[model samples]
Target: MTRKTLILIAAGGSALLMLGALGFQYIGQMPPCKLCYWQRYPHIAAIAIGLVALWLPGRLLPGAGALAALTTAGIGFYHTGVERKWWLGPESCSSQPITGLSTDDLLSQIMTAPVVRCDEPPFVLLGLSMASWNVVASMLLALIWLQALRKS
Candidate 1:
């Protein structure tokens, strides 16, 4: 296939994945955590790069798309690590110590806490959490982007 065609396919795949995520969040009522939301940005960037690659006459688009894919993959990997307790995630969304808080402070915290957290994995498939799957999928998208780059 042509470079443009390949980039289009990669972009379409990313778009579909994004739509599926939104569907799960809205229709399925599976709200995304902080880390989960972070993983979507790179796909958005890749889609934009794909649009540019489709119309622009430059070889750099594919490289930019590849970078975007890799960026998401990195975030996914970090999120998976956070979910698995390999490391701490964002302090704002992850668990925090509240052992010594007053009653009023505790109540305030309960009212202000996020509905979903970056340290928790709410969905899993075949022993892999959504973050893990994102890592794999984003890596695949990166490969597709790289292939487009090679073709260019």
Candidate 2:
């Protein structure tokens, strides 16, 4: 495919994922946790990078887009591991505990705890949670970005 077509595809793919995330949150009633939100940032960045690449002659934008994809892929992997109980997630989200807390600290923790957590898998499909799907999809995006770079 041409570089322009590739950029458009990459941007459109990210847009679709963003819209899907919104649909999940608003229509499907699945509130995103902290890590889930983190995974989205790269996609948003990639969409912008793709747009810029469309107007530029250099390959830097596609490379940047690849980096964005990779960053989100890493987040997705971390989130998947957290959801699968393979590792601890963020202190605010995971149930790893805020150890050695005093009475006041415990009260603060209770009051400030997030309603949704990064470690909990709110939805799953074919034994894979949303995070896992994100990892797979984001990696695919990285491949697409690489192809765009090659073409450029």
Candidate 3:
């Protein structure tokens, strides 16, 4: 396939994912956790890379896009691990028991706790969460980037 086609596929795929995320947030009443938000940055970067790749005549942008995809995919894997309780997430988002807190302190902790957490996925499909789907999609986008680089 042509470089232009590859760019469209990669960028369009990222755009679609972003839209889906937004839809889940607004329409489906699903709020993303800290890690979920973290996974989006690389896809945004990849979209920018795709736009730059369209005008540039080199492999750098595609390589960067591949890196971006891999970054998100890695984050997704980490998120999956957190969701599955394989590892601890961030301290701020992770809930810890108040061992020696007074009533006032316990109340404050409860008041300040986040409604959404990285350890629990709001939705799952076919035994795969959104993070897992992102891993799969991002890897596919990475493959498209590699193919674009090969064509170049």
Candidate 4:
């Protein structure tokens, strides 16, 4: 495929993923957790890089796109781990220490905490959570970006 075609596939994939996430949020009524939001920033960056790379002639932007994809994929993997209890997630969205807090302080913390928790998978398909799917999709997009880099 041409460089432009590869770039389109890579960047368009990110767009589609974002749309899916939004659909899950609005249509499906599934709210994203803190890690879910973290996974999105790199996809947004990839989309912008892809748009600019379409007009430029260099491997830099394509490489940047690949890096963005990889970054998101890594976050997705981390999120998956959090959901699976393989490792701890951020204290803000996951479990936090309550050892030193008084009853009132604990109540305040609980009240102020986010409604969504990162360690719980709100939706899963084929035994994989949305974060798992993002990792898979982002890795594929990264491959496409790498192919575009080769063409450049």
RMSD of each: 4.7, 4.6, 4.7, 4.4
Q: Give the better candidate number (2 or 4) by lDDT.
A: 4
TM-score of each: 0.86, 0.85, 0.87, 0.87
lDDT of 1 by residue, 95-119 (tens): 5577989999999999986578787
The C-alpha stretches of model 1 lying farther than 4 A from their native spots are 94-114
| Candidate 4 TM-score, C-alpha based | 0.87
Candidate 3 on 31-85: residue-level lDDT in tens?
Answer: 8888889999999999998998999989888889999999999999999999999
The global C-alpha lDDT for each of the candidates, from Candidate 1 onward, is 0.87, 0.87, 0.90, 0.94
List pairs with backbone clashes in candidate 2.
none
lDDT of 2 by residue, 91-117 (tens): 875344568999999988888865898
Instruction: Give the runs in model 3 whose Cα sits over 4 Å from its true position.
Output: 94-114
Clashing pairs in 3: none
Candidate 1 versus the native: TM-score?
A: 0.86
